[model samples]
Target: PIPGWTLERLHKGYGQALQETEVFYDSQTDHQRLRVFDNPRFGRVMTLDGVVQVTEADNFIYHEMLTHVPILAHGAARRVLIVGGGDGGMAREALRHASAEEVTMVEIDAGVVEFCKTYLPGISQGAFDDPRLNLVIDDGAAFMRNTQKKYDVIVIDSTDPVGPGEVLFTDSFYGHAKRALTEGGILVTQNGVPFVQGEELTNSMRAFKALFADWGCYLATVPTYAGGPMAFGWGTDGPGRAVTLAELEARAAAAGLSTEYYTPEVHKAAFALPGYVRRLM
Candidate 1:
């Protein structure tokens, strides 16, 4: 209603007011629209294609669940692959494991990486500067299809399945991801919130069921992602990948990892889906 004020709303097939900011940076990259704006309560926020990807206030919840669950469960994943996390927050958590020898992050957009590194340094904390990280600018699907390297963990940190991100949610992409991992390796993906985006979880779970021996979905709540708790798709052929609380506690101590939102107890609890979500999968 003001003459000079501008509003930015997140359009998740439905519009919701996210923030209104006067001081912000916006970019039109070759891949998508990237905006970083300051929010009074959430601190700095990043949105891609009108969807909130991360906020300085709650990024740890998303990045931690995305990284730790697979890495910690695998017990000794030295080689890791990250698909589409251009902001580098996932890589930062993966690198915390001293066992991680190499982490290859394949992001389609170099601009997203450059911009996030410059503006969201607090989130990634210079993860791009780490020697163990191999940053590749390429399509995630193409990289998965072409690479001969096998990783102990492969994480799909993609945006929603639209535009350039659509290819990543295909069955073909999941097949390639399964092939790119070593035996006992695990693959995890961002599957959106089942409360608002149930079809996304169903589609991903269907693909995983056909490809992996043991596949399931887990949960984490990121306030910025709204609607409900966010789901992460889990697929693996590894025996005993779903560890008990005692097993997780032992590994957590061994890894000596410190986290804000993820604990061994929480990790075990995340897989306990609600009744409706259980039916969805």
Candidate 2:
């Protein structure tokens, strides 16, 4: 209960408090209570409804893994679809691949995008202005249900499976996302930390197992998304998951990407689930 610190009580028993060096934006949006503040260690931080969403320091780990893994694994992801990445960090990473000709990002809240652009531009880094990006402001599940256009890779960069983001974790939504993919396309989702949010990952994986020929979860240790490694749900009818390490290395070299946390080795190693997480899948 420090005077100036913002305590994020996402879990019932666990919480993280960041000392707010400067409060940037703290108010209500149409969907949730959006707060953007400056912290000494994490730099700019954005929180939605008292839960930390993204931070300047370690966003690269989340964004890079979510975008690069599927795109690079697919090896020719020309069209990408992003659901609920309003902050534009996902788009920034997806657009990094010259192979991705078009990246369509569907976000529910235009307010989140607007405020993120104004307050946390460094996280997005001019991705919203990219010519290849087709920004659509809409509900992610609805868009997936109706969109006739197929994608090589679809990333569900949504918040925790609660409130507005709850629908994104449902079996019906996973079915729609599976249908929205082109032949041999991949679908990845932001399943929460398995240690704390085990049910979330299990539910998503259950749906994925029913919908796709291949279904599993991967690990990424994001400092902000506490409780061990955060799991990204992986579901695909494609052979992307079977891609070898040598091939990934070649792709990384060809793309010539300069990343902070992602590499070909990391990409391959991410899928090796620990025993506890494996039981959830």
Candidate 3:
């Protein structure tokens, strides 16, 4: 009574994400995986053109932490830009700042944006419908080089450094990103897994250091991401001082911002690293 699953365990274990979804398994290597969600529940999940981008329904955890942390850290943000999040989840979070004057969402895929707007509305939640947003369906790299306007915060919601999104992980991109920010402006991006992409992590951090005088990589635990953990690198022209739990709480309260995951306690603790991770630098 199963569809194309000759192996019952594959169907049973990954069954939740594969429901009403197509699972494309790799024949050659242990790395290839993709699941396309066709039904109208959480949203459609599309992997990379080569590798699987999202394998589970719970990928939102990684998305959420990546987009919001840098914004909140800036205290009061007035303008924002999100490069390559066609799904609109990052846009939704970026708009949470009441002080945010305008948000420009530049996504490369019209198909992904349309699909997410139609089916994956839960994660994005009608963000495309917001008046504060200006949607541009185009390549993020080209947009970065061309735009003269600066922003208070920029969130790079790109996939891994694969294929079309590869240029996003380069020093050239970081150079443009530094120019795109205003004085004391900050930029944050999905830095990939600490376990699998450690050298990548170091290079990213070093790149940020070259671009901005004050820059660092911070982490959060998102189970569905990579190995139940994920990291995001932040680039800033300002100082990187430690902000305490109570201090963040007071600021959020004073600013009257509503938050579910990022609190002062969580924010302070998210930067905590183990011994091996400590040795990564």
Candidate 3 residue pairs in backbone clash: 47-53
- How far off is model 3, as Cα RMSD? 5.6
Candidate 2 or 1, higher lDDT: 2
User: Residue 190 error for model 3, in Å?
Assistant: 0.6
Candidate 2 lDDT score relative to the true structure: 0.94
Say which candidate scores most in lDDT.
Answer: 2
Q: RMSD of candidate 1 to the true fold?
A: 1.8
> How accurate locally is residue 220 in candidate 3, as Cα lDDT from 0 to 100?
79
In model 3, which regions exceed 4 Å deviation?
Answer: 1-35, 38-44, 50-60
lDDT of each: 0.88, 0.94, 0.68
**lDDT assessment of candidate 1:** 0.88
Question: Ranking by TM-score, best first?
Answer: 2, 1, 3
Q: Candidate 3 at residue 148, lDDT? A: 98
**Residue 203 local lDDT, model 2:** 94
Per-residue lDDT of candidate 1, residues 194-276 (tens digit) = 88889888999999999999999999989888778999999999963568889888888888998999999999899889998
RMSD of 2: 0.7
lDDT for residue 36 in candidate 3, whole number 0-100:
45
Runs of candidate 1 with Cα error greater than 4 angstroms are 1-13
lDDT of 3 by residue, 1-281 (tens): 35632221211133122334443232221222323454344334555443334422555566556655666677667899999887787787777667777999998777677655654567677788899999998789999989999998888888777657778889988889889998878888887777766776787887887887777767876543435366787888764335555666767787676755667666667777776665664
Expressed as tens digits, the lDDT of each residue in 214-274 for candidate 2 is: 9998899999998889999999998999999999889988998889999888999999999
